[model samples]
Target: AREAGAPAAELAEITEATAVALRIRRTLGQHRVREAQLTALFDTASDLAALRDLDAVLRAIVHRAKLLLGTDVTYLSLNDDAAGDTYMRVTDGSVAEAFQRVRLGMGEGLGGLVAQTARPYATGDYAADTRFHHTTTIDSAVLDEGLRAILGVPLRLGSRIIGVLYAADRAPREFTAGEVALLSSLADHAAIAIDGARLLEETRAALVDLNAASETIRTHSEAMRRAEEAHDQLTDLVLRGGGADDVAAALADILDGGILIHDADGAELARARTGPQPPPTPAVAASR
Candidate 1:
């Protein structure tokens, strides 16, 4: 009986060991899945950088979030400077009509609050939270549709807020800390791309202004060259027409918009009429 009991005890111990090994394997598998998801997120983001169309990029961002997080809905809100309002850029059809209609202040709603604070907002029970402002659109459609979990990460350029990225699940669920970190990292990559595009636009505008200024300067310089040529012609004509005394009087007349001529010795020679002077004489010795 003792020998039989020993073998049974060994069998029980082996079963317990096998169960523990299975649990560890399961945990490792989950961790690997999470790591694979994060790797996919970064891969998608790296691919997106090659695209220049801002609208398409933003849409891709939302779509990818919904895919990686296994959420039914994803939304992106951007700050509209012209309207001084936060406007939705992407909302899966699951987004409520009310959310589409109303604009939220910088810190008013979930997305807005996330933008205002520059942090992530996570909730497993959005329906039960009074802090959530469902309004009529979401209250009837989304809440009723079973949107139980929410996550929002702010998009930023340096220290400034640009918008928010949001995801929602229909069933009550918990987001792992690793998931939140992955999302926030994705948001950071997006902000960097957005900032780069904006800076590129600004640089193009500045180049345009600089080219305009350079063109203006070139035009004024051409005008000055033309004026100088015309002045030299007028001066030569006056000097050729008059003697010292005659040229001096003419120079005085033209001096109020006139010309003076001096000999090579620096002696005052002639001032000529600005208007048509008598035709040049061979004996005038060209005013000098």
Candidate 2:
């Protein structure tokens, strides 16, 4: 081009203009990617907010992670802090049982490193990565699943690291910084979903117990109301100079059972029977 006699200063200006154009194009592309990722994060938040069932929420998280990351496999592990390990809780695009059930100690493997540090970690070829502590069990599962490239991000709740979310590919491919950021954003959503689901479950259980206790209290209150009404009725009868037979009849009607009245010295005064109940014996009436 220089030999073709295009002006040298013009060529320099054109080259610089071309470089500026390339940079602009690259920035535009990056902006589009970030916009798409932000949209995905919003969608994930909306989807998770509507779900109350824990299992359903977890399934949705893994599915969304797989979709947004466009990885061959995606999975989530929940931290069992009491057990001192993070265990696989949900998976998508996984065919290996061993891989699906893999568990990692708090500081083992790439996922464990995320859990331990509460940050995002990625590798183009996990088997050769020296930045993470590898374990036989995790390695075996990765091998079984045929995963080469892996990205793991911490699922966090406030200051607590709750678990790890992963996106893995079968072939070695370096994950971009944008991809890591995208996955980290998704991981934040997943953590909120899990924590919120558990809280909802607890709330539902509490509501059930509260409802049951309320029913018991209502039943007892109803019984007490009937007793109060019966007492007031019997007192009115006495105030009106009604006889013992009046008392016996009122008691029989209200109790739905045979009634007996006795005077002092164990002498039977009156008896009433209702509903097919056998008449009270004289001995029973005298003893009342």
Candidate 3:
């Protein structure tokens, strides 16, 4: 059409119109991508919400991350405050055994950087990235897994960094802004799931403790009631003219131990014993 002697003004208008059409198509494609991201986030939220176990929730989060990002591997690491480091918690599509159990010190690797700073970090080529501190163990794991790209986001709970969520690819790939946002969304849900499961476990343990205390209190109360009844009965027997012998026998039966009553002159007035007999002594009776 351009070679058919078209007017300059007409050709310019056509070119502009084509450019506008391309722009509209690009905008529509972007919108579709955003829509898919939202849908995936919603589904992930649903999936995490239904999980009650801490391990199960973390596993689901990584699995969803792998699906949404289409990555070769996904995993989560939790911060160990006592150790001041982060350790691998769960993984999806990961074949490296050492990587699954690797621990990263604060500011050590990509996940460590995220945990220390509580921010997102991405690298198209992890082997060449000098922005993070590389350790022999982490480097070995990454190399073994053949991972070149990495993106990590902190699992933050009220400004406190508890852990990090990561999506990694086997080959070099630049993660886009949309992909980052989606990852952050998934991390938010994961944090909630983790915190919720922990709280529930604590509550259950508290209830168990409370129940044990209640049982103890009940047993003590029953024992106290029986002791009070025994005290009343013993007092009534004495008031009804029962002698020291009766008191000694009754006390021995109740205490399941030896009983002896003495007079003012240190003479044994009454004695009762069902089991091993305690040797009689005039000095002991005087003291009693």
Candidate 4:
């Protein structure tokens, strides 16, 4: 319009109108992005609600984190009480083997600081950052992965910090506070899902143990009943003046095996056989 020699006042109005339109477009774009983020979060919550497998749930969480943050890598670390450290549990857009398998001691690195303090931390240049306690192992892995900017947030369940969720870039870039808060929110959801999955696993194992114990008890009870019934039958046979042969026959029927009796002089008195019978042993003679 200015090149075409439009009036100054008219040109000013046009420029102002163009500026207003640009602002509106920017605002709409931000709203759309926010809407998409909200949709993803809702989907994540639904996934957690119907969660069955912990690995699947964790993979989904890290994948969503990488997508939402638009970073080079996204990953999660889980605390190992027995190992006394946090180890990487899941990763998205990661190719380095060492980084995927990295373990961070408490207060050892950016992730360790986040896990230890239960707070969010970010560094635009991790290699140059002196705010965190860096270890050779962590530094070597980070260098190998070529991650320069890093952000980490605690995975908190109540006051306990179970792990850390992280986003990183291969180039130096500042992480905004909004990004920190967003990752933290995702971590909150991830924490709850992780805890729930663990509890469900424990419950399943306990149920299996309970069922095994119940089965054992039932088998023992059945054996006891059979033994008592056999004892009663033998007692009744003796009370009725049944002979030694009758007792031996009853023993064979109850035990489903051969039965033999001998007197104190080592002379055979009665025998009942389900199969061929063998001669009396020297132990029987010794007893006589």
What lDDT tens digits, residue by residue, belong to model 3 across residues 86-178? 999999999989999999999998999999999999999999999999999999999988899999999989889999999999999999988
Output the worst ten-in-a-row residue range by lDDT, candidate 4.
274-283
- RMSD per model, one decimal: 10.9, 4.5, 5.0, 2.3
Ranked candidates, highest TM-score first:
4, 3, 2, 1
Model 4: runs farther than 4 Å from truth?
A: 263-266, 280-288
Report the C-alpha lDDT of model 4 over 121-193, residue by residue, as the tens digit: 9999999999999899999999999999999999999999999999999999999877887888899999999
Return the lDDT, model 2, position 89: 92
Which candidate should be chosen as best, given TM-score against the real structure?
Answer: 4
Evaluated against the true structure, the overall lDDT of model 1 is 0.74
lDDT of 3: 0.91
Q: What's the distance in Å from true for residue 93, model 2?
A: 1.4
- List TM-score per model, in order: 0.65, 0.76, 0.79, 0.90
Q: Which regions of candidate 3 are displaced past 4 Å?
A: 230-288
Which is the better candidate, 2 or 4, if ranked by lDDT?
Answer: 4
- What is candidate 1's lDDT per residue for 192-274, written digit by digit as tens? 77666677778878999999999999999988886776567557767688456654664454444666565665455555554
- Steric collisions counted per model: 10, 0, 0, 0
Better of 2 and 4 by TM-score: 4
Model 3 RMSD in Å is 5.0
